[model samples]
Target chain A: GAGVSQSPRYKVAKRGQDVALRCDPISGHVSLFWYQQALGQGPEFLTYFQNEAQLDKSGLPSDRFFAERPEGSVSTLKIQRTQQEDSAVYLCASSRDGYRGEQYFGPGTRLTVT
Target chain B: AQSVTQLDSQVPVFEEAPVELRCNYSSSVSVYLFWYVQYPNQGLQLLLKYLSGSTLVKGINGFEAEFNKSQTSFHLRKPSVHISDTAEYFCAVILDDKIIFGKGTRLHILP
Candidate 1:
């Protein structure tokens, strides 16, 4: 079975540019999560979605960050006006049993803002 | 608010030596504990989890951890580690429909 996967393994963008990171969760997964991991730091929650409904966006750092999962499978994290502070690895995970189930993570997309 | 703490930032051990990575959580209610391993250029992989029942839980690559309710800790231990085990380990706890992860510990393997 294919695990969670993210596209564009690496990305480089200039400050003020917009960037979008995509994630494809495993088939049949009902829950999806996005996290940001800075250098030498653990991943911090960004947002969460259950099916096509966005349940939690409290973890998102600011208004520039946005996420959506319309079809209930593929989710995208879009950043408007990238900043140097947004340079980090963005990880996506999926679960079968919502929050209680073990999360399966993707390889992550490393974004660099210059 | 729930949080996880990884006491050590890094631990260096010789190959074939025993190792332990300490982890503690700040939640009194029943919790789900997990250990995840991340290689240099790979995604995080689940090592093991303690949801309920037996305190000692075994995981892949000959790793195991014990869940201690009294001390509020879930420390990962391995009798002997291999060079392949060199990676970043993260301890996480689930509460309120969210999973919080510790800073993570880097395991350095020496010859």
Candidate 2:
């Protein structure tokens, strides 16, 4: 079965530039999530979506981060004014429903702010 | 809020040797535990999960985990490991519909 997928596997951007990362969740998955992973560190939560609603965004570090899932199947995480601190791997995951279900993750997009 | 801790930053073991990766979590509410493996340049793959039922849970690639609610620990174990098992493993807990992960443990398999 096809798993979650993300695009722009690697990206390099100048400081202050804006970048958008895309994620495609598995079919019929009711839950979508985004995370950030720094080098040698565990992934930190960014946001979560249930269907088309943005349920949780507390883990998004700053106001510069914004995420949206208009149709409930695909999502985008956009960062305005890219900074050195934003350089990390952005991971996407999908699950059947809520907390108890297992999440399937995407390969992630590595963003390097240069 | 839930927080996870992976006690070891790295673990090295010879091929075919047994291994254990320690994980502990803290939460005021009931939690669901999980273990994920990430190969180089790859996304995380679910190794196993402990939601309920038996405390001993078996997962993919010959991996198993023991859930200890009293200890707030979900440690991953393998009786025998292959070279391919070398990767980053993460311990995570889900509470209030949010998933929190630990710093992760890097497994190095020596031939």
Candidate 3:
């Protein structure tokens, strides 16, 4: 694809339910990132991946949140026991490592917890 | 830890008038600054960035920002505004390989 791709542009899940959000980064990109944007707020970093390695996960709000990129091209963010506070837009971006390049963001997945 | 603050939650400007949006950041290490714009129902687009060199950096859409390390500010400015320039603007700072974003400023260009 020409740009980063995110699946399920919108998702609705009940409280306590589990959900998974997927991101397909630009091909050959070495760095991928996930962010969470609340209403009227800017995106907050969630995690980062360098190729297949999960370089950083410090921003994950809690243990309920987990992310992985097995092959380095595609990543998944899984939330166990979704809560109302988890409702937000999940954005995925990819960029090259070692240089200050612009990150390409996807349309984002709007998640709602009932 | 890194943090960015956009002092103005909203800015309203008449078309053709000049506008400025203020942003500040706090970081323990040297930083990279960036501004991103988000239109309705669209993803964010990078407007400009300040990595190093001159204090002033120009970005797309005739927008520019000045980095003031002493004051810890990177304010975005435009000489003229248009209706189409209305969007949500975000300030970001990269610190210790982590990116931190501000709450955002909503720019409303009036006719």
Candidate 4:
């Protein structure tokens, strides 16, 4: 579709298991972002990419979380050695250009760690 | 640094009644204000944004917001609400590429 799309709408992982979430941003969008939303909370920024460069990732809770957009289109968020605290909905959004006020978002991937 | 505050965690209104969701923000530099809506089991969609121009902005689904720079506030409103409008609303600000979001306000439409 024209909007952003995410894979594996839902995921369940055991403690110590690694998980990967994929996001396909809108065609040719210049800016992409990842955010984590816990239950009853708003989304918190995780990382952002302008083209193929990761400019900021300060919101990433720990080193266990990593994100990449090697081709500047499809991106992946990886969580290594996941713990219960890692459970949340992972959201992906994209803007037509850098610093654009409007952004398109995907349905998001719900991750549950047991 | 930028931050958004949604004072009301939950707001209830009967169908067809008007409702308002309050939001406040703070930023040292130039910023953009936004309102996002999230349905159950879904991600967030932009409802409206205040970039530049008129203080009032209109968005999809009969939603509107007024940007008050002096008060640092952007509150979302709908003249009439529906049960379908029940969802979590988030207020956010874009400051130098960082989007700070509020905890959100859940709009409960009473039948």
- Listed in order, the DockQ scores are 0.84, 0.84, 0.70, 0.74
Each prediction's fraction of true contacts recovered = 0.84, 0.92, 0.66, 0.76
Candidate 1 scores a C-alpha RMSD against the true structure in Å of: 1.1
Model 2: per-residue Cα lDDT over B1-111, one tens digit each: 457989899999999999999999886567888999999777898899988899999999999999988898899999999999989999998887778899999999999
Quote the positional error of residue A109 for candidate 1 in Å.
0.8
The alpha-carbon deviation from the true structure for residue A68 of candidate 2, after best TM-score superposition, in angstroms, is 0.7
lDDT by residue (A1-114, candidate 1, tens digit) is: 999999989999999999999999999999999999999889999999999999999899999999999999999999999999999999999999777788999999999999
Better model by lDDT: candidate 1 vs candidate 4: 1
Off by over 4 Å in 2: none
Please give, for residues B19-110, the per-residue lDDT of candidate 3 as tens digits.
99999988655789999999888888899999999999999999999999889999999999989898999999888777889999999988
TM-score for each predicted model, relative to the true structure: 0.97, 0.96, 0.96, 0.95
Worst 10 residues of 4 chain B by lDDT: B25-34
Interface RMSD of 2: 1.1
Kindly list the per-residue Cα lDDT of model 4 for residues B1-87, writing each as its tens digit: 467899999999999999999999886566788899988876688898888899999999999999888888899999999999989
Please rank every candidate by lDDT, starting with the best: 1, 2, 3, 4
Order of candidate numbers by TM-score, starting with the best: 1, 3, 2, 4
Error of 3 at A35 (Å): 0.4
Per-residue lDDT over A2-101 for candidate 4, one digit per residue giving the tens place of the 0 to 100 score: 7999988999999999999999999989899999999888889999999999999999999999999999899999999999999999999998876554
Clash pairs, candidate 2, are none
> Which residue pairs in candidate 4 collide?
none
